[model samples]
Target: MTPTATGIAPTTNSTPTTHAGPAIEITGRLGERYDEILTPDAVAFLTELHHRFSGRRHDRLADRMRRRFEIGNGRDPRFRDDTAAVRANPDWKVAGAGPGLEDRRVEITGPTDPKMTINALNSGARVWLADQEDATSPTWKNVVEGQLSLFDAIRGQLSFTSPEGKEYRVTAERTPTIVMRPRGWHLVEKHIRFIDRTGRGMAASGSLVDFGLYFFHNAQQLIANGSGPYFYIAKLESSEEAKLWDDIFTFSEEYLGIAHGTIRATVLIETLPAAFEMEEILYELRDHCAGLNAGRWDYIFSIIKNYRGRGARFVLPDRSDVTMTVPFMRAYTELLVKTCHKRGAFAIGGMSAFIPNRRDPEVTQRAFEKVAADKKREAGDGFDGTWVAHPDLIPVAQAEFDAVLGENPNQVSRQRDDVEVTPAQLLDVHIGLPITAAGVHGNVSVAIRYIEAWLRGLGAVALDNLMEDAATAEISRSQVWQWIHQDRETEDGTPITVAYIEELIAQVLGEVDRRDGDRFDDAAEVFREVALREEFPTFLTIVAYSRFLVDTE
Candidate 1:
């Protein structure tokens, strides 16, 4: 069922009431157990958060736009001279790893559906990233049900049964630590409206709704279970944003009567601007900070999106060619480890989005080999842990970290003092091989297939043996847009234009299966709107959500 929102409904005896605050109204249908999550106290908590921090969220988003404009006008992002003290000071350190997060060698990331929640927790990894951002379609049902799943999982009641009578349950005696990832600050939840002091109504902040609901419902319970409300902050562009999160964490602890510094967050240094402010970001969130992750896919997309107009030197080649070993990615990851260990925080590596194909042994073996090599590089480079998308890869990633970190929780003590990265090294995108026709076709195919699945309410889809999520989709479409705008030609010197791209899209669509209920046609339209348009869309997900996903009933 596609969840939609209408106007507010009058409160009944069964509904939760907000006695003294800015009013909130639920426009989406209250499914079973939804009321438990959206109780009176929970609504009031969300209302309070909106009243206090929504304006600051708007200001931060505006800052992002202004910075993007400046970058398009040739203003390069550099490390801040004013924040040098935060970088130079060797005495300060983050609050380090929290209780269950001390050893996160193999973390598995996936959506929060009941089945996935069961699989991920029982995957034998140290941490399960119950992702609500990139790996979830934010349909109102998904939004509420994801929280429900996490709520049940935390209480040891989450399980699922397939139509074929197979049962899925978390049988592991010790499940992974749950580290929830809320949506970024850019998105909004249209199903709920927050009416402020002036009677002005606005869509609730997605970040606040996700974090607030989870924290409100599960913070105390998690604390009792020996795990705090840990998080992985996504898509932050500056340290000021980190400071805002820190403030939110502090306020949430106070509001819930939890201890100060009870919440720990690991900021994903994904954006180009964020790469320059690693130390400052860690400093801002030091009191509540766990570490930083090399969000490699989104980091690549950020580079292409921010510098798309700057010509060939900044235009990256095919997505496949931009491996972590490239000079630019190496600079980002090495610098992440250095900055993290320097501040006494855990340094988590990026996701190895490889899914084993059981039908073909050769293919699965190759993927395993590649994943092992990738994890080995990360482990050798001083990353305390890394992420994988499949359960089968847990031992593969853990073995590498185990070889490096035997009898130790992490290698935070092995600080890479010799590592130094420059602004040029971070911005260097000229080292990869040239683009090819095969690359263009691959991007079009993946974007279309992934978008179709996402439109169908599935966020993570395995395509051609790789687990493709929103981050991968963003990089795919953005690369296509960048190539067309820069008038990039394939290695064979065939020009890339809108006409050629349209033809390629048609060909790719033909190759896709026309299933009975598939959304391939709609997905193709979205691709054209985002990739073929003259003006670049900030996010393809936002565009598709506003048009097709948001249904008002």
Candidate 2:
């Protein structure tokens, strides 16, 4: 029998409290306690709590996380925003997705390391993503320290004290935009303050949100600073979840002198349910949603978590020898882009893996070719970008994205505008524009993006989304790379060419136009769905699928 805290009865069972006590440990599902912080019942109860806990309990604990760690207890009576134009930016709502939504870019993610991020940046895709939550050490201390280092790197730190001095590529920083994946709740406030100070509060121009409430508090803090901050919200499962955030934003700005629409937001589409309600969520939050970014790993984990009752049917069996390109991974990427573009926000793709694959030089060349082909496919579908892990593979990553952007189109490149866009103006695009029928992938941007990815090799790495690879994978992918010249035919037999790529996109767009009308109908929406169809890579997916999207059967 176990020892009793009160010495009452060895056999007497004690109920667990929301807040752990010495008598009742706070353990995770495995029943292993950290300093006797948990018990079996505690673990079981916590797991159930994630799905069924009442609002009263949620409010109490969430408030604790905020008050104790400065994570965010909900309303910030002082927070205010002046930049409402970001909400009404015309660029946020691109009419006629062309194919899928991520039609213009791909992501090449690396670890949180500076070297890894720079490498991926050299590749060519539009965004450089960094992470601190899943791929990096999850402890509070390491995460806070690691994220601060990235912030320093981004601000172009100067060492007036030390002659040794350190500097990054170009005068300031390369790549059009920067994205970071900071630690979630556990170290949220610490991480935000670090980035803010490191960047000299330049984070004022940046948007920072973590994976959960932990992530939101940082953004709240930033907004509370008499400024505006943007965010990419992750792990969300429903439109109701979207509404909570909307309400959170609403209340956060109430009383504060800030503009209601200043806080731009994008959703990290990770879970299956989120993936399923993609379009509806997009439509519902069309006023607030910035865009949808793909989340492959978490998406897979979600299917396993939520669909295990279906047995083998839930996830695919592990297949060796070939890359794990599951139908669902591909499907998820496609749907993400479509959802984002349909509503006018950028449809961004996610990272492939944490480790760089392709150890043999020949294998590397072949893999690059395959990845390039896939990028073209995604561009044709409509994804604006995708993610990469290794800097060496940046070129490979960008080569794939080049096809979708097409000569820059001379459009405004900033994330926000100065004046408000009326709902009527937005509705005109939503209801009046014919659904785009363009689909194809090929161009200088594609090759340039790849070149940039390799150059970054992690040195010019991203700060958002914990997509493994980064340092370790770079060497492996490089070891296997053959460095063949561009425009070579791939192992998949797809010839690389801008003209041919454009034709491909045109075909896909034509099909999309046929499915989408001036007005939306449920069945038409289903047909336009990028996920429901498997064999055919929808317009957006063809561009976003990298080697690491993960195969879901």
Candidate 3:
């Protein structure tokens, strides 16, 4: 079996003796002990999931496209008439929090690298969102090693040593609960291919690969430890998608012999359409639903992307100017709290993407103050918990939540019935703030830098004292595209055109320091394609990943 460019050999074998599943081929290089994570049984489980649910995933994605086309053609999203019953019924409630997820007051999110796993577990946060989505680059090595890291961490044997001889370990007496967040349904794991009956092979679904692999490997162990297979579902756009996840969870639990309803999920209301379907989404996954999170960064990006073609009224201001206090954002959060609490579910707040600069005390102090205020608002607004990017911000966020939820695990009982948000309020994008030249420059700089880092196999990067992930990068590039299409101008009366953006990209390249193997050139090209093209790309990461990350011959 000679390996191909993707590092695994192409085979036409319909049945491998190792398992009784579909023909599955590993197209990625297996690292040391990677075989343990990608065992034959686990691969069979992934194959089974792909066989059962991949078609529905494709259909749902097509539905997303059709909906996006409707929005582009002036059909604004409103509360669905079909799901009115689901939303109107007030007696129903979700399953609520599971064993280890009762108090997610402070969840520290990061990539699933070995060191990050140790640190996040040791962080004072109540939940460690083991991220395999936005914060991960999905390289073959990263995907495999992430599973290995979590494998070790779950068994209490994870550790790492730095090149400078420093040691890291999960040493906290009471570590945070682990909540794995897999990639959304839109992505595909190119390194693994599933061969259909006709000898045709296609990339495996990224969501199923991540979720199936982790759950297959760790579900029983987690149950033995008194925790369950908890998850954070990201980037869902409709109740149907939520139902798909719920179905997957049910099937997985049954297959693994775990008790029913042992799997709990908190859905991230990141998409514009999803905000309108929050109640329906929770209702679809009611038996397995834990809560809804304010995925604020992606939520902003979604608004800009969905309404990009609706003219100046839909155009957003500078990214910095769009804070939580903005009308639309406020409406979204308040509505989320109201809906979740009304349904007996926790209402988690958004991420504070502030990473402390250790050398600069003033900058660190300012970051802490800002995060404190942000968490304070969420806590006061009846949120059960919030998110912080770095572990250092955990204490700051926990302090705020602690001040409000002193002895209570959560404030799910505090219903926000006074909140009544209309579709107009949710669609109102009037920021009234002027877009500044600095905003344009910052967008260009951050997009290029973040893309460069992602191309170098890093998904989460700290730039300008904040953690920039795929979501933030989406906002940066989408804003650039939106501004140019809407003929937006900076405050000083300079028009935002492709030529001007090209000049800015050049200037930013010169200012940004390049490492030995930096991908700044490629990153700039990608930014230009996504940000300056007449037809907006749905996702910048998708374009970059298919081009740069996949190991093609």
Candidate 4:
């Protein structure tokens, strides 16, 4: 077992049978029924949760590179005056709605592959985010076939066929409520390796190997099918990465005896420093918190990688002109529905990645009237649920969260309390409107059509009708590397250069044909080496997964 330029090594008397120690080995290639999901108790519960929280996720990723070198030497991220007594405690609330997540209006995400996990658990959409991060392309055979298609979709033993023989399954009597998401805490799982407490050997936490192998094989079969072990948390920034996911969900509910608020989680206020620590990250996961989402293109690629070169008042515009009804994405979704209904939780909303082109009935009626005026403005701004990457726009975002939650399964009691926002209006990014040339050739044709479908293993594509992923190729190559280092210009003025994005990536890789012209000319030289490089990598799938997707020897 050798393979290394990223992973694969295990079998020298395999291991990881934890009481929180040794047995951290399983390196990679375990295909064709990956030992029913790399078991040995899911590699000893992801090597005892990466040897207990990989040192608080490497000291919160070295306090996120010392707060991105103090927001690149000017420091602006506000709201955390040392968490202000956990956001002034305002009668704490979080852990309440659990069991199949008490109706999540209309979720529906993608990529767990077995035909988008049996068409997102038969897509009626009451929640089915099931992605293994940015609609997956993790490629250790799509992360061990997305944990064997969510372990045959929580025991319904998933189905699929399609090499034009069309099959697919999950004829829902009850589905959707799956949640999952994993991979972000800056991804790793390089085929898995462990030895941490200083013996060194690393690469593991793709958020604790996708939440410790899906909470060690579906936490008691998704808590005896009433659905527990849910989660979505990705790219967190602070509330100390939500208290390192509330101490890895209280050490995975006391190492799977399961029951301490039976693992909930939602967060993903998508980093502009997690939208001013949304009430101290919902009071540090108020006991496995389940709320807060609006992750619009990774919150505009975390506000162009935390305000790159902080000038032109944090310039941003044209990643399809930033609209979640603008004012800095409506002050980060009205302060995430007033910090998740003032802590009772459940906010959600953001993602109508729109993909309906069944022979274009006027491009699916102008994308269903722009996803019905964006889910009737997130159900008239209180949200309780919203996301639809396509299941025919899930009854148009569940008929606008069922006309503002009718038989009321949620709205978490709509306490937006005339929301107040601020942190200079979530860094207002000088009220948007600028960059164009059709948004710089729609960010060089959606970053060379999503890095040539994420180096061919594919990570959710759909293209022009929308549904692109990997957070839309990381907000289209971080807005073409912050519009070629802010020489931005466009809208007929010109500037955005690097030789006009390498002459529009050689006229869009010479109109792609010869079997995808050398993977769109290696995805336009990995999108001009991470968009005309000057060092703003942050994450373009961590250097395109160690240079054009790993798997060496």
RMSD of each: 3.7, 19.3, 3.2, 22.9
- Over the stretch 408-511, how does candidate 2's per-residue lDDT look in tens digits? 52111322222222222211211111111110121111222222232223222221221232221221111111111123233345543434433543443444
Query: lDDT, candidate 1, residue 451?
Result: 93
Candidate 3 runs further than 4 Å off: 1-21
Q: Higher-lDDT candidate among 1 and 4?
A: 1
lDDT for each residue of candidate 1 in 298-327, tens digit (9 for 90 to 100): 999999889999988988888898899998
TM-score of each: 0.96, 0.47, 0.96, 0.33
lDDT scores of the candidates, listed in order:
0.90, 0.38, 0.90, 0.79
- How well does candidate 1 score on lDDT at residue 141? 88
- Model 4 scores a TM of 0.33
The clash numbers for all candidates, in the given order, read 0, 117, 0, 2
lDDT of 1 at 188: 90
The reply for model 4, stretches above 4 Å from the true place, is 1-75, 80-83, 87-110, 115-129, 136-152, 162-221, 225-229, 233-263, 275-279, 290-300, 305-309, 312-446, 451-458, 461-468, 488-499, 514-553
* Model 4: how far residue 92 lies from native, Å: 8.6
Candidate 2, run of 10 with poorest lDDT: 197-206
Error of 3 at 123 (Å): 0.8
True lDDT of residue 353, candidate 4: 74
Q: Model 4, range 239-349, lDDT digits (tens) per residue?
A: 878887898889778877777878888888887887888778778788888888888888888887878777667877777667787788888888888878888888888
Instruction: Supply candidate 1's per-residue lDDT for 460.
Output: 92
